[model samples]
Target: TQVTCRNSLKNPLWSLIEIPIISSVTCQTVTGLIFFQNDFCARILLLELKWCVLCLLLNEAELQQRSPPSMISLAGGSPNPNTFPFLSASIQVKNGRTVTFDEATMKRALQYSASNGIPELVTWMKNLQKNLHNPPTASYSPEKGQMDMCVTTGSQEGLCKVFEMLVNPGDNVLLDAPTYSGTLTALRPLGCNLINVPSDQHGMIPAALKKVLSRWDPSEVHKPDSTAPKILYTIPNGGNPTGASMTAERKKEVYELARLYDMLIIEDDPYYFLQFEKVQRWLTSSVSVPFPWAPTFLSMDVDGRIIRTDSFSKILSSGLRIGFVTGPKPLVDRVVLHIQASTMHTSSFTQLMVSQLLHSWGQEGFLQHIDRVIEFYRKQRDAMLSSADKWLKDVAEWHSPSAGMFLWMKLRGVADTQQLIVEKALEKEVLLVPGGVFMINSSDPCPYVRAAFSLSTPEQIDEAFKRLSLLIKDAL
Candidate 1:
């Protein structure tokens, strides 16, 4: 298919245009995620969506069982559950309790489920959001309003979808500095102009955001109509590498700046449940949840301007690769559409498994489990801090993590950690991530290094720091 314009010279404004102004448009159907094909540029995305129709049809197939009982699921290609070899399944938790699924339930688990998520699991997640953050928005309504929320293969996928949905070739995007390395990977290849906002121990600086926007002024972004820097991405809770959570006041101020600049906030909070200092308050029988961490941007998003990406990787199980995107109906539904086209849905079996466990635990038991998890990590943090104090106190300085698994350390004399950690530390049998990897400009020198306390034993942490101290001394 081709679109040929015969009267290009007839338009007077075409003579002054610098670039070729749509002289010929190749209007062809592209396979998979390539939006369209053109002669000048082919906007190729990383996601493979060529087999999307099969998944879309499967979604309808899965819905058949939920439909009228009089209807049979002949349209579905789902395998018969009775043919499955497994009879029943039981999973035991650390608390020494087994959640058993009987034959019927096991059969259901073996089958396909909804695209968004298992309905019960999605509901449970929504209730958890209400109990914890309690945004101004209500439930999911696909026909009337937003899809409310949808589960993704991982939180990063959900976040990436938003980036794909909003950003164009030359659009400007705002993000906190010394940010997550994963964030840079997600945004960089999109060809969008990346603007770094200065941050402190309290997270993204509001004054800095205002300053960035003041220069942008919508017009300077080279975007049409609305605001130029439309998306502001941040990791508000237990920031990656830095491990610094935002103060409530900072969140309020940031939200205000977003409102003023007409920007949407994307709060990527994977460590929301892992705050070390806060004691877990038990949720009562009525499914109410209370968290002592700083106010989430979602809580302050009265205008439905905040889209929060949360993960089960930290709190529940990392391998599950399950996470939910919560925000305004419009944006969230768009994400769902992407999910439908790509992964179709998060694994229905995993979704049902997690949902079952939560059902058995209830809200109170869930918080109790979180209490144990926090205690375990707090001990790990303390062990690492103690080790650092004994070995590297004079060589490096670090901020105590209030939550999560990382401690950000700035070497006293080292100018760049790249060669030191990657080359020297590897030889020393000590492994720690160099800080330059997390920076937006990877080639630049960075003095910082991230020390993780998640997996190392106390003795291991102590020995690693001792070797790190030696590495530092040798460098100095």
Candidate 2:
């Protein structure tokens, strides 16, 4: 074995590596040492999934660590975890089952973890990606069109960082209209120019998207055209505010358009697991994932151009603040660098807790849990629908949500919902978000209102819309 330097001189882009037995893979960098376990399993001799980050162009320094029997590891700046006062820990699940964290686990959780994440959790999520969305571009090579993922504080952080990494200050990015207010809040402050693409019940319309991008010739897209935006941001499945999922045809067309225009797509799909109630039969006891869940942009991604963020907040505990970013090696590497400099990786304990849950549940158990969640949300959505029909049928028009928690309601005979929702609805002891906040120009008058069905009871929902109908009448 050549010990280290396993093609370091020639393949400078491969900036990261993993253990011989350990199967976790993440893009560490192009400048740092390329460590390996022995000669490294060529199968697992992973590549640097390229990061589209602010280049940390280090001088070509040849660095690699390889195991030589029992070699003393003196590298890395992590503090000794043995010094921490906390020892064992445990938390009981909903069924009164305890998931204990022993000394070995506590040491890792209480102490500092790698910027990418704890290795076990990283491996688990990567495998989960394979199960959930067998992305076509799934590869470990440091070559172009490689996919990699990193856990984040929340999907929002991952989303925001990726947004920051791709969007230049003046670059006009294609953004979905009436998007998540949180998205508008996160992106608008960055000062990047946005080109709004209209969306209907089926999410972002391809026709509207094409019309906007038609400003510049499609042939010039693959070129380095400064004026043309190279990014299209969307939440295709169970989208926020709108609560709509893009049709399968639109998803295909959107991916093709992105290919044609050479544009990178950011798929912020937090509500993916919340799709309409449909039982997904598991083919295996452990891991035979044959697309039980709905298809994703990642599933169709052949060019490694999509950077998708999935959240645990909606399905699991929001306080846990755990999520993942999956996309091309280069762009994800930038997110890793940003995470290192920002929150210093998501809370290690939370990551471990999630990992522990997954380990105990296995893939089948985890998906069953998701099925329960989907059914719960479906009930909630139906309740809201029932209430809306009973109370506000004539006053508000809305499409039944395909997934997620929110209902987007357009009031009849109302020019804008701001004054009605803010002043009148509040006076009536009812609260709803005015749709203008989700707009690029939040100051403009908007006729729609967003209502969340996740928390309220059927009776309360009925009463709220009853009051809302009265308010709409008053406004008119």
lDDT of 2 by residue, 326-356 (tens): 9877567768877866787788899889988
Name the runs in model 1 displaced over 4 angstroms.
1-58, 139-147, 218-227, 279-290
Residue ranges of candidate 2 with Cα displaced over 4 Å = 1-83, 222-225, 277-292
lDDT tens digits, residues 1-476, model 1?
22222222322211111112121112233322111111111111112122222112335545675688887555556788899998888888877878787999888777767777888988998887887776665642322222278888889898888787666767678888888998899889988888889887778888888888886564333233333576789998779989888888999998998776667789999988888766344344454444556668987776666788999998889998999999866457557767766777888678888998888888778877887888888899999999999999899998888888899999999999999999999998999999998888889999999999999899999999999999899999
TM-score for each predicted model, relative to the true structure: 0.84, 0.84
lDDT, candidates in the order shown? 0.74, 0.75
lDDT at position 120, candidate 2: 80
Worst 10 residues of 2 by lDDT: 57-66
Model 1 vs truth, CA RMSD:
8.4
